[model samples]
Target: MPGSPAQAPAEPSAAVRSAAAAAWWTRWWVRVLAIFVASRVVTTVILLIFAANQGQNPWTGPKPDYFSFATIWDGLWYNIIAVSGYPSTLPTDGGHVTENAWAFMPVYPGVVNAVMFVTRLSWAPASVLVSVACGAGAALVFHRLLRRVGLSESTALFAIVLFCVAPVSPLFQVSYAESLGILLLAVALLLLVERRYGWLFPVTLVMAFTRPSGLAFALALGLHVIYRWVRRGTDPFPVRERVLSVSLTVFSGLAGLAWPAIAGLVTGSWTAYTDTELAWRAAYIGYVHLVPFAPWFQGAQWWSTVMLGIPGWVGIVALVVIVALYAVLLFSPPVRRLGPDLLFWVIAYSVYLFAVFFPQSSTFRLLLPLFPLLGVLALPRSRVYRVLMVVLFLAMQVGWIAICWGVAGADWSPP
Candidate 1:
């Protein structure tokens, strides 16, 4: 036996190699990156398919390329802002304020302009790149947020999967500010869950400017303060934290209103921003004053009467029932798993939307901010359920793009 040649080390079997690959795929960052890339590929294809069918519209000629197609809708407004800053003299039609760049925030286009300055990339590429990068960042931060909220790693990853394939996920790779806003929100919520109040100041400031979320966040902070105070016996809301939280809430509220104030100061018109916003809804309900918690009811009535040919009161009653159902959902066991911080944010944001937003096609896009609820959907560990939901979400992405992103004749749907 000693004289016999020693056998060389055996190679790993196919099964062993397969298992090793599986293990590598299970690593969190690897999985996240893989999912993000794959989702982008899928979304890109869907967008290309739709872009092929595109007709001559306000945004592009027939069958425009991907970048041209992507930069349509709100992207065109952002493009205008990036190139030419908002007009100091508000544009009016027939002595009534018209929809203009004031309705679009500055931070997103500003960032895109900066990117173009540094990288020498054109508007479409640079804007889409920023959005895609922010979206990827959002997905990573979202996983951590889910973990912080006490979900398991697998469940958290599943939530990311659902997020990447959601109906509005096309916003991630387009020229929309949603990706940046979502990235900020995921980080902000993670900070809130960690009780990092001081850091939230800067995050809240940027978030407020990036999108219309500051006031809602402030409302959430206020609610969070009250909740902690009520549960202080067990939660122990310290005086330092209490003072800081209170200050942050006030700051956020001011930040929320800061844009409108800036718009007014710049245009020499006190109602510049609100007027511009109201103009978009004018096509449906005509010019109206900004009334808190009244727009949704108005929207319901208008939509019911105009579209469905039904009584307006029926729409109002239906809205009430929907609100009631949502309130019930907030207390559901799955939503409660997200903890008080996220739950409060959801409630406050929903209220803010109800108060300000007119229920329309854009309603789904506005609901993108409530993405934390995806965690609830991800809670079920059944493999079949997760697969089916992912399939459904992908299908919805197709429908959403066709309806909202593609411009038909006199298209009313906006993503």
Candidate 2:
């Protein structure tokens, strides 16, 4: 009876497992990465459901048929260039085609075309695959770069979450240049930190080629290298590194100034989106007398009216905090070791966006990639603020998902 009474062993408790899971969540970055992965899954699910409901082929159909190269905005244009082979001139058919001011940026289209040439996959799948690769790459690169810049592992993860969950982040994974641009920016920052001035030059070339805004980074980085040369009084870097840096300096600056000219040369007019400031004029204000015709000064028209409200006030507060943090970071000893690479990129990115883009749209999709950089530069040591940043980005991602889902049902028909 005593032996019989000795029952089988009790199962292991989930409480211990739960405790371990809780600890895992507290690590900050793991939590942030989890959130990001989940958001993407959620959005992808919605897209799948949308495709199924519409009887659209997730594998193949019309342009954005199920979910391929076809995207709204510039994505459609690039897909066209990729599929049909780059046409020297778009087949407009005299008001038959629908194009937008934001539709042009030769680097992105050119790269997609290059991919098509090698892979020979039809435009749709190749474009989608490349987008996914670049987006994931950008996120991974940003995570590492932030870690190097003195961010806590949790803070860096949060930074990744911020990028992935931001309203514009989906584009990083979709058919857009932002994903590639972010990757390049992160790589450039890493090279800059290593003081591989020579290597930086080629990286600079890629940056300039990817986005016109890259020219600013090129100037800042080139100047830094030149200043280093003056300080060392002897060539400080390895010969190869010097070659890349010098070459990049030329490409970044020369290529930067060349885009508009190229566009004008192609279109027979300077009114191409890259060349024409009036292409999609919205919030811009002429600055002939002041800060010059920069995007932010121009973009002031967007928030100027909105700022008259409460939400605008919040943005104003956020802007002030960002600026103040930038100033403190300039002097903070803890981050002093990271040096100027990060600071220069932040300034260059912000300045270029403010100087170039318009005022109509508030989220400034063109500059959304800069948020992670902003978060890195402004990452507070406080636990509370870190949590807030994670929460804020999650909310933004959710909002964006909602907006995109709403668009799915529309006949916006991919170009």
Clashing pairs in 1: none
TM-score of each prediction: 0.94, 0.67
Cα deviation in Å at residue 34, candidate 1? 1.0
After superposition, the stretches of candidate 1 with alpha carbons farther than 4 Å from their true spots are: 1-24
Off by over 4 Å in 2: 1-39, 46-70, 84-103, 110-121, 152-154, 226-247, 270-277, 282-291, 294-298, 302-338, 371-388, 401-415
How far residue 63's Cα lies from its native spot in candidate 1, in Å, is 0.7
Cα error, candidate 1, residue 389 (Å): 0.7
Cα lDDT tens digits, model 2, 121-211, are 6656666667666766666767777777677776676566667666556665566677677777778777777676666666666666676
Residue 277 lDDT in model 2?
A: 45
Candidate 1, 35-70: lDDT as tens digits: 999999999999999999889999789999999988
User: How does model 2 score by TM-score?
Assistant: 0.67
Total backbone clashes of candidate 2, pairs 3 or more residues apart or in separate chains: 15
Clashing residue pair totals per candidate (backbone < 3 A): 0, 15
Worst 10 residues of 2 by lDDT: 282-291
Worst 10 residues of 1 by lDDT: 25-34
